[model samples]
Target: MSKRIAGPEIERLIQLLAKVPGLGPRSARRAALQLIKKKEQLLSPLAAAMAEAVDAVRICSNCGNVDTCDPCTVCTDPRRDGATIIVVEDVADLWALERAGAMNARYHVLGGTLSPLDGIGPDELNIKALIDRVAGGGVSELILAVNATVEGQTTAHYITDQLSGLEVRVTRLAHGVPVGGELDYLDEGTLSAALKSRTAF
Candidate 1:
């Protein structure tokens, strides 16, 4: 009879699990214990799903969204307003905007924002692709929905500069106070933007 297995295999699994975001050694240990308790119900299915996703998931060539299909559902959907495209940083942000159910326009995922310090420039991102999409015509407005970080703002400004000569309307998300922040702790940028965007106040 073969001797029982322990130590190395469990340690390897825990180490690999710890590499995932928000999961440290403690959480990985707990998760491994749970998986051991219900291997058939959780571990097997989880492994299968991860394998399937690895094989099937791909970035959409048109908009940079991740999907099993090439164009992704949003790009393939006919009802979405193709003439109005919302430019975002990543697929997660795109999904967040979609979940809001307020934006009727299509999307262009930039993959990431411009961060010169990090050596991520326009060429590294999907800025050229976005410009090409605009140049192809039929697009009436391009909404800059990148995050409020410094890199995000820089990327947005770069995009705005690129489309300056193009015959399309460009807009940005109105920056302002958070719904829950105390008025005294607000930053200068937020206060200025909020004041500039104020209406009938």
Candidate 2:
């Protein structure tokens, strides 16, 4: 097949953009064209920002949160509850829980869940680091904010088992219907959990 293509540079940009999570070839092409058309306002600034991020962004050494700081702002924040830690499956989960603004505790990103079939085990996650933090003995409670999926539950169980001998208490998030969700729209699992966790009104 003859290589029917635009300029090599533009083609390369489109190809790279298409590899992004939510973008496809057509959308990437459109995006690239827009970027080119608005080079001064968008493309150049985006390029500079990408370069700056590449230089500055890093994984936090203490909690596995991605930040420019080695310990991350969350870990270093004195206002946060130093005796409480919320464990999550990923950085995205950490951000989500932060946005909820329910707790002012520190966080530990597990990096991923325990998926034996996919060959992702405890060793692949930040489980040991979490144990180390717990064992060091300042934290009084460790809240497992992992997802409700099988792998997420498995990971939470494993962590709880690891902290069994420690003085710190371990807790998991309560499962129930979402904030705006109706009872009729909920799944069997949600309904069951909501019933099991029912409280007196």
Candidate 3:
């Protein structure tokens, strides 16, 4: 091991920071140095915020959304169209949809898509919760806004199979979405168009 200049504690923090997406060892080191330089203004508050988030944020019971409260703001909102629910793979997808401002329906985060080779099955995701939501009966449409990847299509088909006997209409994002592209990376206009032109799967 190279000489540990940061000491075990700070080195541990750097390692943990590096584990976050879009961050690497060098970025983490730079971040750690910046934090140490502004310990009182940045590091302390950041640590406190992280602790508070870790303690308070949890998966919404109804939709699998991470929120400070159960049911989440969207699920509990009276103004949202309860008759339509968009099914997405993660909170980031949900955020993307919201950012587009085209979807007035509530969302159900699947947590992940079906991946047999990765050993991730339907049961591992929030499929059961989605079924329950559909079964409760107010939803008239389910828009499958999952990614266009192979696993995403598989998961969408799985959801369609699950909802086959139900009265609710099931639709999918339009073909404009590029294969293997995540919704989070798409621009607002493209996402809006996809939502507007969604077709039956």
* TM-score against truth, every candidate: 0.91, 0.96, 0.84
Candidate 1, position 103, lDDT:
84
Report how far residue 101 has shifted in candidate 1, in Å: 1.6
The lDDT values for all models are: 0.91, 0.93, 0.91
The reply for model 2, stretches above 4 Å from the true place, is 1-5
What lDDT, from 0 to 1, does candidate 1 have? Answer: 0.91
Query: What lDDT does candidate 2 reach at residue 1?
Result: 10
Model 1 per-residue lDDT tens digits across residues 29-132: 89988987899999989989999999999899998999999989899999999999999999999989989899888999999988888899899998898999
Best model per TM-score: 2
Candidate 2 TM-score, C-alpha based = 0.96
Give the best candidate by lDDT: 2
| Model 3 vs. true fold: TM | 0.84
Q: Per-residue CA lDDT of candidate 3, range 14-80, in tens?
A: 8898998998989998898899899999999999999999999978999999899998999999999
**Candidate 1 vs candidate 3, TM-score winner:** 1
Query: Better model by TM-score, 2 or 3?
Result: 2
